[model samples]
Target: MLKKSELKDLVLEYGKKFLFPDFTNKLTWFVAGVGGAIILTPTPLKLIIYNWLVDSANLNSGTRFTLAELAPDAADYSVGVVLIIGALLHNIANRYLVYKEKKASSHDVSGQTNQIDKELFKKFLEDFPSNSDSIDMLRQQDFSNSFNIFRLANLEKFVEEWDTVEREFLNTDLERMRRELWEACYTFNYKLSMGAYDLNGGPIFSCIPDAYRGTDNWPAHVDEKIDELNGLSTTCFKLYEEFVRFGRKSIA
Candidate 1:
């Protein structure tokens, strides 16, 4: 639950968002306010215009002001009412359009995720005929070895798979995973090419690898990288489990 102040702030924020979706909306309301007041209020300018019209009509001898004389009044705010309603309708329309666009974008991302999930399942099945065996293979693998994780899981292939999905279909999570995995793979290759570490070490950062041989605070840096890779590994495993679940449900 929110406190009174927090609730008030939230309400004000949303109200402002609704009323002023953009600068153009602010300008629209400004014009509406000034124009409506001018047209609706019995101001000097309006009276002058009205009197001029009446005088022009009386100048024609054949035409006489025969009706009961009445003063122009806008106390009822008729024009202001119309302007307010128009502004409200415009704001509603803008919000509705934004809502529709976001909904459609969400749907597109969902469809893409489903498609990728099915593809991953198919790939896993191809690698291991038995679903249980496929899962066992994933479970038994070492995640601490970032290189092994990259190679065994064929992270590059999945990264490419994302490329096939339209850019617009890629959501934040998907893009993030792809970028992190790609970086892991790229960093491994870069280190190997630079001869920073020998191939005999198996590219595991269990200790101060050759890459950080002379560097100060290497342990902390290595630990940080290890944790980062560990996170990616965990995310990959969770995704695989989700794929299995999705596949089972689809088959059922």
Candidate 2:
């Protein structure tokens, strides 16, 4: 099994190389060539070309192949697969760059980018707790906190809570702090979720009503999402403290 950081590195490396890669790049050519080959093979159109070759050679007509050599379904399926994969790759690269740019451009009170904030970035890299033990120390927990732990039903309410944080809590006029907090939330959000899509609150689910539309079990897994959001919220606060507690103060 691949280590998490190694896997992340692989994804970023390949995502950057193959998604809208320069024409001269080998990985770009490889993706195009492989995708083309996949679509062209197991297709009748290829058989027609082969037949032309056979006839041109005129060696013999003893080939046992029939006219239906190409499988139409296979061609259509390959096209769809290639298109979906290509679209996802392009999207992944775009999102990665957006997050990188957001974090990189953020500055300290001394006007240094967040990237050079070694201790803060180190904290950013640290793994958060799996259980709520740390959270328990920070605040009081009750039935309501665990009530949605694994939502058996009532997806609407679960998503409503999520949207409240994303829209109301995150939307702010404090330009620097707001942007930094958002980037922190999004970074944690992306790391926790396994899927390729951003899934980072506002970017993934604009509102409560729309959260469950594309998913199969927002109602069932609502609790896990709640857990994620809570964890991200905690991390966002820590990131803010890193700015305030340290001598950084605020953006220059």
Best by lDDT: 1
Candidate 2 lands at a TM-score of 0.22
What would the per-residue lDDT of candidate 2 be over residues 54-84, giving only the tens digit for each residue?
6765556565543345555544456546754
Query: Relative to the true structure, how large is the alpha-carbon lDDT of every model?
Result: 0.53, 0.46
Q: In candidate 1, what are the lDDT values of residues 1-252, reduced to their tens digit? A: 899999999998788676656526666677578657755666555667657777788898667674334455434456567777777677777778778879999988778776765565455456433344323434454323323322343443443453444432223444454455445444443433332233465533232465655565566656665555445445555555554454557533
For residue 107, model 1's alpha carbon misses the true position, in angstroms, by 2.3
Q: Candidate 1 — which residues are off by over 4 angstroms?
A: 1-31, 34-36, 39-45, 53-74, 128-243, 246-252
Q: Which ten-residue region of model 1 has the weakest summed lDDT?
A: 142-151
Residue 164 of model 2, lDDT score: 33
* TM-score, model 1 to reference: 0.39
Best by TM-score: 1
RMSD of each: 15.2, 25.6
